[model samples]
Target chain A: MARKSKHSRPDEAFEPYEEHAGVPMPVNWVAIALTIWGTAMLYDTGESVQESLQDRAEDSDVVAQSVPDEGTLLFGANCATCHQPDGRGLRDAVPPLAGSEIVAAGPDIVSRILLRGIDGPLTVVGQDFDGHMPSFDSALNDAEIAELASYVTTRWADTTEATAQTSEEVASLRAEIGDRGSFGGGAELAMMISSLPDQPPMPARSHVQAGDQAARDLVFAGRDQVWSCASCHGDLGQGDESTPRLAGLPGAYIVKQLQNFREGTRENESMQLVVQGLSDPEMTALGAYYTDLRVPSTARPVLSGDLKRGEQLALQGDWSIGVPACFTCHGPSGFGVAPNFPGLSAQHAPYLAAQLANWVGGQRHNDALGLMAQISEALSTQDRRAVADYLASLPPVPAGGASMARMETQDDQ
Target chain B: MNRYLPLSILALAILAFATLMLVIAPGMQINSRPAPEGLTPYSEAEQRGRETYVSLGCLYCHSQQPRSGDQAPDGERGWGRASVAADYTYDQPHQLGTMRTGPDLLNVGARLPSEGWHLTHLYQPRAIFDWSIMPAYPYLFDEKPQAGPGDVVVALPAEYAPQDGVVVATQQALDLTAYLQSLDRTYEVPADGLRDHGYGTPDGPEPTPSEEER
Candidate 1:
């Protein structure tokens, strides 16, 4: 071994030659120490980064191991708010997905309804709902809608009859609808949806039971202090643009509001003045009479707002700002929930906007459990106007007077 | 000279990490917290008023945050509950201040529900309280010979009233007052909204004396 070069590896002891031979020994030691220090610093400070990287690795590992939970995730994001996670719709407002004849009918019916949405009265499982079901034509893609449809059908439909929806079916349905609006009503839907079972008629609940004749008389003829109900609320109690229509409202809701007005729990100068002279009997009679009256929607979109944006707010809320969809609580088409959430459909746009403003400004404090106040506060002015206009554009609940009366007569037996 | 490259890299890495730890990490944590229930967004008028509040630097004299019971007697001071992170969800560039020159206004709306009182106080602090150290914001109002339609007349005391005209609140004053009125956080705070200071539990202190007296 004649004069081994400094750069060469040692063969005798299996030791490697120093790479940084030109640098000082202390500097070399310092560099080694620094390398350890910097690595320790990175390890200490990069905990979050390390966690995220590991999480990504784990995610990939899981992806390789099993099918993705895309259906469950999509259903949670899209349908869970209204249809509920368990697939039971809210208290007869939204139709239950579980055991639904429509869902069981197969992919065509569900896909069509999901694509175009429904704008008129719908009867599900003997319960009547009049509201707008927003069209997913623009919001969701064919594959996503298919995933949602399949998820709901399988999750809620009878296990033996559960059918899965494919993207091809959704795509075909989308092509056929060709940008048509929501199915107008049950009749129009019946025309489109084949194999859909005949829906049972909704059970009649008496909204206007016979009451004090004296109070009924007071409704038509005003006393010396109070104006007649027809003067502001219309002859048929069909509300105008500002004053709320009393007709078709739930009797209990009307009575509660009247009591709130009387007790000053709810704030309204005109309502306060009107309720001062009315006795309890008169309020009940008026509520009952209004509940009996049925009228067509007279609401027109008067306020200038982005109808598309408004429709989105009414159907799909912006959860980023904590605003929920109007139909979630107001009934499917803003037809109003029975007791607390009043009908927003066909109410004047300006009036709706004003009420929202009142809620935001702390002027109106009678909202159920402060939910409306908090929701109103979250809505921007433009959003408020948009939702109000969209609600105004929705059709009113179909008149069920004749059938309901017949049902009520039967119930009397 | 030869060590410059590695030395610079090490220095840069340290600096970058310091920035991430001190600034980015805290910012992400704050931004991720969901807004507490009952903490609503400001209305248009309230938002405008909040801008006014910021422009006026109301934070200089009045603090919106109250210290915890262990830190001070803020609860006994009738300033309501100790301040929490979720309370400021809608507040951009939070108004938490260190000064106690004036009372904390976190629950001012609940304390002062009268808009007229606020208008009068804004026009001249002495109008309501002769000894109040708060500076008057007279510029927020205008003296008009007669109240115009939609112009809110400030109900000033006879001495504070303009000699020959009525004091009317300008839109800015109304907006600022609306903002102040929207400061009511008296709604029951959710359990998650409380800060665990390593203590057992953070129950909201007794109802403020002012609320009880009212």
Candidate 2:
């Protein structure tokens, strides 16, 4: 045989391919790869198929079709500006993200760093780094942040493998901290995050169904032909950037605000005109109409602020600046407490911004004890923007959304 | 030796690998997260308004969710904190749009709380924002010969409003407005920890220390 003699074991043919002496079947790799590329291309794409393929080739890894990890992308887009793409932050200029103790500490500090920004001095990976790391409260949403946190915690926090931080965990941690330092979201404006009890807001028992037939009738049809709440507050008493909504408001609360407008306690030219000759019954009916109508969510912000900052201002007040938490008086969730504070949750940002500016400018002095003015004056324009945007972004607790009723019930308290 | 057996086994293995990497692996990462606390579903009016918003193709110009400040200056833009998944628990169809032709309206309700302003703006974007690129929604309103007792008159500039009549909001306008107004989400989710996030940074204007110290 040709495969003979000189070979030590001539009798042993090339095992499986005995007939061919080990020459294996060649695969048409180029053809197989083209088929995959064609198959993927055949699936729908955005621009023209050709254009999409071209763009995809440039932006994506042809070998791996999945979108890049959110954290890696976020880190590249955000942290890389200073930290360097390799995550070995510029020595002395910025701290490294990879193998950093802060990242190793998990998502809390990492998230906090992202939300509030690091000012003064921060020690990462045992080296003291000091510089202004801008706050991201207004920029990234909680989920995006969570993804970034997970990515960093797992990918860069350490050289060893680690589990990613869940959006829930990042969210909860964000709730507990970020933007709490100054006039912010719902917690103590003056309290530091570390001092917080780590307790979630006390759960309300039940949401009061503020629906009233009289109110609905008054809202849809003009009360005594003088006014229809729907006229100003679009169909369900959903107000815009200029007006306060009456829908889903506590009946008594709406009545009080109306009374405030009428008595010049709340100085509003349009509202004053609307409430000019409204009688008690008409007001009550109107209040009922809006109260019964569900408050729609409206959080379009004309001027952007730090959502994290806004959240901080709304939850915790910058007691350092004498601003109280919005929730202290407005309810733990900014859902209006009966008879006093109106629901700031789901309110319009421009409206809130206007009111805050009015308070700052001393143009509108209707809140009792000049509370609104005092707080407004204390807030810087930036603070106003933050709180307004934050308050505007909140989802109002529905009338029957909760499991139990709050301590202060309408008319009961 | 059935040649089909190895091929079938290979296909099964490929399917298993795909499921493991694409489905199981990623699912294991995000599925553990619980819905954020204090997140409520959209109300009937809000839902109707959301439908209106979708029908109007508002998503074409505006994005509901905000990206990180690192990605964009949206934080300084006051679009609200980066939106989380919990923010869309009730969002049957998630609106994670990325168009910024206009400003982010994720919290527009809180930003501008006026029905009249919104109505007027809808009727003519130029009325409130002179430089607004948004087209007018004249179809959303009815040109009534006279302003009825309870009819809302859109305070449109003479250029937009009919010279002989007032603009009355139609049902579609109302539905859309309701949805627009209900977009506030300022409440701190349980994940944000204890304090809210609305104050100026320590680097900004120095906050005067208050009397009551915690």
Candidate 3:
């Protein structure tokens, strides 16, 4: 054995073994290769781990693979700009789709909105967006309309549990409304559409039996409780001075208001306290019950007023003051848009006057209403009264009364 | 010789790494400095108030940045102008919060000119807003004890009640208020013709058609 000297040079020592080890083998080379390979493997493993963790965190289990495609195309073409692609809508102008009562309301109301258009004062997501939405009657076919309605109901509005509209239903509505111009406003449409022979009675609260019973029980048990839901809101769910009437409101609107109260966003002390104690289920039931209640046409009786003066102010605003015609947005009647605008007809005069005053006084500060305020401020005191009185005296438009052409023209502008 | 060779290589490697880091890493951002008008160096009292605002977690319920659409008439309602990134350049950690339990406070300082009104409103919101559901911040204020028989106390106006002689406004609140009041952006940029037109700045000729057209 040629024993290697202890102090032999590294090159000399390894030279003899190079052939056996294969490739100019040195002790450090093996170590370096192993280290590099190990690092590469570790990096690959890290990337895989990160990918897996991300996938897990995303919890793709809950998300639907693809949102329903039925109404998606139509909604995108017509509704998405204001309502948003996801149906969440801008904070105020358009109501949310995830849980709106209007979406949950029977197909008639939904179809009527599509046939006519909505306008005037309305609140969505606790903020008010008072803008006009054009009707889609001329733009979409009956099948397309039905598909879009179904999509909005099921996918965006989360009323998947609610009955989907059939193409036949859409056809019938189109036929019935043929050549008849758009309905006047939401109120007019609601009244007319509800009276239709094909229209179903308001969705029974019984459908949500568990929720309705629980809410009824809570409300009934707390009947004598001061400031209970029924105290300011009448037993029939009609609203009083301290509160807006809840009956006959689209279910989606009711739920949004309740959520606003609970979250302290609505900013009414009494409502906050009243809603603070309610569980989510209780709120849902209360909303459903109120939405199902019949809206008695007890809108305050039209008071005798200077009708001619009021009509003039409403139709032709005093442009010198920069006041736009009320009819430009509020509609011939004051029914407003279904989901966006509020019904002004038959509303208490005091409330209407107070709101107009609030707008001018800067107490009410909505972006959409801001211009209206400026316009209101320009009006003489008598002008304000005439408009308000005229608004209050007008009857709510019958359902499906708005014209597709009117809606289209409004939307284009 | 061997030791010397290894040491030299290691030193060179370390120097090269250091140089690389210095060249590649981001440098401190100094441009777009916030205007310091109306802002005072932090005082101990103001600092305490700031700490109080933080502890109360007011940011969770309010946003300082107003949306672009909000700039129209909404700004006149006291929400203020849309916030620019430069507005928060000085913040160590920006508090661009989300939530609107109350109105945005970006321009609240200018909106509420009356200090007394703020004090009274904070003590009891319903006193100011009959329908307000906002929680009262009585803890931020000192309640006057019922006047003792011999104590000669001057009745303050219904609105004016200082939290303490040294009013312990949360330093967070004071700083936040200071920050809010500092949001006056009334300087309208002049159109092209109005730009450097012999008013003072040196760089431009007298009014020309192109400048006037602008």
Candidate 4:
């Protein structure tokens, strides 16, 4: 293209335009071979093909007996990052789908991933995956996403029970979830999951297993520099009307609170002082000690709010006002999720309301991704009070898996 | 044979040779490489999102190809290492636009991983970049008087955040953002790929590294 030799120099040797004037060098065969080899390398690996033709062809011979599973293809394309192709995830880095808690937590938990995407640390099989999964809300249609969710849940079942979820079910849930930014990460997803029905029931006994001996000793008798938790909290780990009852709370939640107190994440002069001289083990032990103790009484309403309204808020949140039911994150039956989310089953109303208000005011926000902060800010004081009082009124609830009661929800707000 | 017939035949042969080199060779050169290690095919979502990218005519402003440092200052500008043909293996009608009125998006996903940041920037670019000439795509978002529960509140600057309501990203905007997020080409180029391998074929070992290293 550079030198139109005939056109440029009509006078000079017009007969033979056999050779290119651009370069005197011949084509580099080494370069061409390496290029082909490199290309073959990429093709063999199958990381970046359009249809993955070769992979499909190879699989067709053996693995293609079943109807072309759209979900498998979709998962290989999308969900394989955190959830592997085989669904055996990479340790704490990504969660495995082989009997993943969220995948089988029911359609609402996992289907929401396609629509809103999930972020923050998620606990699957009790291990945390800190990565964020992007939303496919606009990416995939209802039917495609449905098939994908179905594939993962059923194909990866603990016993291959083959729970086939229909596309209609996915369509309905999609319409229900509507458009929201990523379910605001896992805490919110946990809350949403908790609200769904047919959840695993609470344990028979409260499961108040004992704590570390060293920590139990410290709870009763403060070590050299520290004071005991029993000063304000009752000897039995039960709190008075003003103080929060710590008994039977999840160990993770208890430890987080003590850590929060020490770090000023959840500011409290008393707790800060109590935790000041406590070392990591002492703090962990204190958390364990409280968790293991069984309280004689559940939380009661020290101050009054509308019990009926509180119950309504606790059980069925005012979605019109952008408030999710309290138990969504807390737990089914108002008992809290362990470690991070405290059970609200027997929490005192005034204390709960105060904490909710703190979330609104940005005074207390140690919750993952500051989820409580957003939820509380959207709530009015009365809504917070209604939910808190309702929580306090419930009888003691036993700890159970996170799957919440299945309830139909509004599309957006 | 007539002298004019021989001359005409020579002219025709020359013309045919030019066509082979000029018309067909570049096309072959464009696609002669394998996809790089980190490069992945577009997910269904990203594929759907790409439609938004195309429809919005982002190509008019943004380019997806970055030339090597020797050719341009793109490397110094942090556009990433020079793009290779394999980088576009998954791209259909690759968006190697000529005009670069906006930054090259060859490695945007690596540059900005946050969807929120992208959504906000799409809504009103100047909100974040005070001197930006890119027009705002307010239509790609919904303005709500008060954000509903589960609504994605665009993290706009105070000036861009609506005085009365909140702004939530529209599906198109989200799709486009996903496509943008999928525009990563920051994969560690294979040893041969990092060389002067333009079409997965290198003329010589890369000049920067030692000759023995190759």
Candidate 5:
């Protein structure tokens, strides 16, 4: 080894050797740290991307699942409001789906009920559900008909053991009906199918009479002095322009609304003032009376424009502007599907127009109806008149009628 | 001495840069607060009206955002734009709500022509809209005594008078009118009406429609 020069210090002596070294120690540490941080950031970003993709994939899957089983969505959207999400049915007025003999009966009986709505007194699951469940035969396709029937058969009542129905079966039965005529009562359906068990006998007409009288007396009498129900609702409860026709409404729905009016939950200053003095018994009586009255088509207004315009608007909303047609939920005749949507046919045109305007103006509040209001506001005054007139002019499809069977089946699905 | 100068200069520059970043960067944010180009500050009465709206839970059913799609019935109903974040720079707690029991209220004040009509409709919906299902807000107005012949009816207040010089106003009605008039949403930038393009965000250069041999 050569001796170091006297001018070079010990640290300076190493400098010549250090020149050959590749990277400094501190730079190496920094490089490693940066690499680690970059790796972590990339990992997090990848995870988030994966999560987002998974969510989108799941949503698409749900849509795909819904398309094939469209009946499930239809049933949920339409019937779940009244029959409940589980298909167990509602209390008092609606029959149970749990172990009903009716549901377990032959498919023809069920199809008949779907084709024609049950009118007069009826019982379900040992409980009375008197309201009409309208038919749906014309609205849904044959495939939809099969799907709904299958769903109802497999899901509700004690139908786990019963054989499921096919689209061909529903289509065959539809053909026999010949242009979708109405089914009068359970007896008629029973007569058509010998194997089907008879429906419970009709309740005594006297019971209806007594209920009507009690309701009439309560509605007619007022504290001090005021207008009677007849003054606003008209003689047979065929409502005029100022008020809605109350006849043919489901009793349970009427009772709930009347109670709401009296309690101020569903507030209208005029209605509140009108109902303010009535007792609960009186409201009940009023509901019973209204329910007993027969609905008359004569009361419905004759529309001016082409029914086609109304039909187009009702069935297929002006999609160019993203408007949903009214019939999607409110049925073809404007008779609402359930307790959630009130009947529109036979309703006063002025009342309909005002309600539409009010909904647009924010003078009313209903989550679903709010959507309708938004859509309604887009309409010109003339369009509103035309639509309302068309709805008013539509014939009331009779309860338990064949025309409504498809509608009922689709609803159940 | 000269050899050490470069190192010292570099160290000083780095320290100075860090200090400037720490001290000055926060101040930049103050001026950076977004201001939607066309909006103006609300008037004092309008401010009060906004407060009244918040207190009344009006946001529960109504939304401020209008959909971006071409003239949905909702837009035709005069509920203004599907709100952008820029539209709510002034809002402390944004009122772009979700429930829709009633129509959107972003441009309600400008949409409805008459304040008196709103008042009457609010007071007695059934009288005006027979199928109205909304709860009445009678507390908003003082009940006018049932008019009797020869009971010299006082004219409505000067503020309540119609803009066309036709009608008079009540105090409650005036306050409510102040509130409704405050709902002007004219500051919104109109969407370019392009079918697929989203709002606010700039898209590619506009395509000019061709004239057919004009």
Candidate 6:
């Protein structure tokens, strides 16, 4: 110490045991990391640190358990098929649910229809329909029907008339109706709901039957029943507005329809009157005459519709609703399939739409196994119009001429 | 190079495992299933028609398999119920076609029961429908001055018929019609294997519930 050598300074003795570098404490770094992790958790998850654990636990127990729109789900499942989601009904076939008087009248009528299923000859909004609505009592429970009814009422019924249905009310109505067949047509239904319009009586069943006359008159000649086929149908059997063209139709098909009219199985007010005086032989003669009569299509499309949709229904059928293309059974171009399926090409649009409506209403049920009735039910009013217009636009016969061109082709072959 | 034997053994084991899992197990399961009720064996004529259908590429456009309601509206479309594996017991090589360019033929017989309609349709599809894009099978028919005894004459439209002769269905055409008419799978099957797929296709526009509905 006395020498104070050149190698060592006096300040070295005063220095502490260890040098103090300007580093922060380890605890400070850990605190900063913890703050960042907590911030990230709160920002990304939209969950606070206090409630995140609780939310996860509750989520596991009731995952996707919200039942907010129960009525919507039920309506879509049960009534949406025929009545349509918007409840407009399938025009003159099924009745409209939107702004429907029956729906507006309140839950009593709605509940009864749901439980018992109303059959037609039911008049809704001045339009007559004869559909066969299958009872939903067996298919849906009281609660489900209530939900469906409420949904329909709320969505389509007039706002002033909207009434919510309860399961209790539906249950009581179900008990009151008990087990019964469909409300006997619309008359019986009108009795329960006075607000509903009356369904007009079906054209009285003609007492007239085919007489025992051996009349061999041609189809063009006036008979006792009709003045002449040419009066309503053209001279060449080319039909007018809303009248189906009889020209070039299959003999078997015409005969079958004539027979159907005579038997009163197929309901046609005019045809019934006409067939009453005709014998089986006379019917056969008319079939032959019409089958032989080949005329170009002069019947223009009267009903307005989407031609594209009509073409699709005629050519590619809307499979979405289970309707096969018109060509599938009616033949390639709407020409009649012999003995059963009729030719739709060049047919009157109004007539086609009316027939489709008839099928939907169950007024015309003469189709094989109710095929038309089933298919027509699936088509909307717009779809029916579209198909009708499309068929009316097509040639009744193949392009070029008729048998002459076919014969020429055969000769060439 | 020395590990060649081990490598080959490993590859053989893997191949055997795949075969056992994929082919053998499924084949055994399918073989054990019983045929559904009313599933009768194909008749001689129907079998021949089946052969004709296979040869004619009818499967290219028409499907024999009508899927469940949930998958498609085959039932509502009047194609009958969904097909089951047991439904194919009579089929030598099953015709569960994938394409639906045409309607399903599984229940065509039920929908159209007339033999005459089928014959006419086969002879000339356009004779019944003027706008049908389906190719005509005029070759399947023979034009004769008059139908002979036991000959089935096709009832065609006046324009499509030969001016001097009636069109008679050939044996092949008859067989094909018979086959089409025989495709009736409308009988009920056991509910065990039948699944409910719901109506309409998956791609169909789903109705979204609005806020008011909620």
- What fraction of native interface contacts is shared by candidate 4? 0.00
By TM-score, is 3 or 5 better?
Answer: 5
Superposition error at A224 for model 1 (Å): 2.2
User: What C-alpha lDDT does candidate 3 achieve relative to the native structure?
Assistant: 0.50
Best to worst by TM-score, what's the order? Answer: 6, 2, 1, 5, 4, 3
lDDT of 3 by residue, A1-413 (tens): 24576664556546554334555567679989999999999999999999998886565533434444546756754566446787776453345656555666655567767765554333333444343454556445678778777777666454436657777899898888775544333434346434322222232234533446767765444421112455335565544221354553444445666676666544444455456567777777776665545333233311222445555666666677787766556543344443434445444433455456656776455425467678767765445545655654543332322222235346557
The digit string of per-residue lDDT tens for model 1 on B1-214 reads 8899999999999999999999999778767778877788999999999999999999999999866544554433335556677888889888998788998888676445446657767888775456688999989999899989999887654667778878888999999999987886655456666464433223222233323322
Interface RMSD of 4: 28.4
Every candidate's chain B TM-score: 0.84, 0.76, 0.53, 0.80, 0.58, 0.85
Candidate 6 wrong stretches, greater than 4 Å: A1-413, B1-8, B28-45, B55-57, B60-89, B96-117, B126-142, B148-151, B170-172, B182-214
**Ranking of predictions according to lDDT:** 1, 6, 4, 2, 5, 3
Listed for each candidate, the true contacts retained, as a fraction, are: 0.00, 0.06, 0.00, 0.00, 0.00, 0.00
Ranking 4 against 5 by lDDT, winner: 4
Query: Distance from true position, residue A159, model 1, in Å?
Result: 24
The per-residue C-alpha lDDT of model 4 at residue A298 equals 41
Point to the candidate with the largest lDDT: 1
Evaluate model 6: give its lDDT: 0.67
> lDDT scores for all predictions?
0.68, 0.62, 0.50, 0.63, 0.56, 0.67
Model 5: per-residue Cα lDDT over A352-408, one tens digit each: 655677667665554353586677778765456556655655444343222233345
Specify the poorest-scoring 10-residue window by lDDT in model 4 chain B: B203-212
Docking class of 1: incorrect
Model 5: residues >4 Å from true position, as ranges? A1-205, A212-214, A251-269, A302-306, A366-369, A397-413, B1-214
TM-score of each: 0.37, 0.38, 0.30, 0.33, 0.36, 0.41
For candidate 1, lDDT tens digit of each residue in A1-413? Answer: 55566676557877776675477789989999999999998988799788898997787677656754888866655566557779877653466778776777766677888887765566666666553465666546889889888877777666576577789989888888886766765656666556455533333334334435675666666553344566556666765444666666666678888888888777765466557777787787776677656555555554444465677788778899898888776654555655555666666565677678778777678777898898889987667766776676655543322222233235446
Error of 3 at B75 (Å): 32
Question: Model 2, which residues run further than 4 Å from truth?
Answer: A1-214, A223-227, A400-413, B1-214
Q: How far in Å is the alpha carbon of A153 misplaced in model 5?
A: 27
